[model samples]
Target: MTQPPLTTNQDLDSARLREAFGVFPSGVVAVAAIVDGAPIGLAASSFTSVSLEPPLVSFSIAATSKTWPTLRRCDHVGVTILREDHGEVCRQLAGPVDHRFDGLTCSVTGQGALTLDDGVAQFDCTIHEEVQAGDHVIVLLQLHAVAHAEASMPLIFHRSGFGRLSASA
Candidate 1:
């Protein structure tokens, strides 16, 4: 049996790469902080655990991101693993900076981390390191605190859309 021709690497562009990458479903998270006395954040689908010994987590931020510059300067960053019902909240985070947290409920730590009140889980962290990749920066965060709601289902991102997982039989 022979496989069909694959898209050539030479033709790989943003659209093609995004389409190919979107085939795999990933959980979404909200990375936020209180920057200069105000809340600021962005939604990210690239969150993952990085280390156990030092209690580290990671998420990728686009190189062109305007919010990242501000959040990175904060004393701490809040990483919220969004709940399945947070589809609208995720969109708001990606929308205009002024309206991001407009009608949302959130909590801010004394250290400046900000997390959605109803997220599946939340983490308070400080920047550990930042590694620059092709078009994004991989941020490694050192976790200082964590909280969770085990019954909550996480928001998922797949094929450039939001979704949720079904329970197994």
Candidate 2:
């Protein structure tokens, strides 16, 4: 098949950029912690493993995110890779900050890190670095602990929506 020609002179706005970026599917994760005696978090589809030598991972937060400022104050942050059935949970995390943990079972560490009990994988991490990039900040997290379920599939985010992967052949 012939590929379409790229429009070199076309302007790329935020909406167009988002639509282009969403062409690639990504796993979604919840970055959370106990703040002011309550669970606080937000869903991020940008989560990725960054390093192995020092055990690091990363996710990006928009410059306008109100939750990051609060959650970043915690000593440790819990990163939970959402399970395939966690669409509603992800929505809750992205909803009102006060109701994020409502009706959900989560585990909290002594250091204030919090993770969903039914997540596909969980990580206890601390902020290693935060680099400002364009309209977002890339947060590098140093992993102190990790856990996973052997038979769970991860939730996927694509084209501004949540989806589950089909079983492997």
Among the numbered candidates, top TM-score falls to 2
TM-score of 1: 0.96
Error of 1 at 3 (Å): 2.6
Query: What is the per-residue lDDT of model 2 for residues 1-169, given as tens digits with 9 covering 90 to 100?
Result: 8887786878899898999999999999999999998888999999999999999999999999999999999999999999999999899999998898899899999999999999999999999999999999999999999999999999999999988898769
Q: Which pairs in model 2 have colliding backbones?
A: none
Per-residue C-alpha lDDT of model 1 across residues 7-41, encoded as one tens digit per residue = 45568878988998999999999999988788899
Top candidate by lDDT = 2
* Cα-based lDDT for every prediction: 0.93, 0.95
Q: Give residue 162's lDDT in candidate 2 (0 to 100).
A: 87
Q: What is the C-alpha local distance difference test score of candidate 1?
A: 0.93
Positional deviation of residue 80's Cα in model 2 after best superposition, in angstroms: 0.3
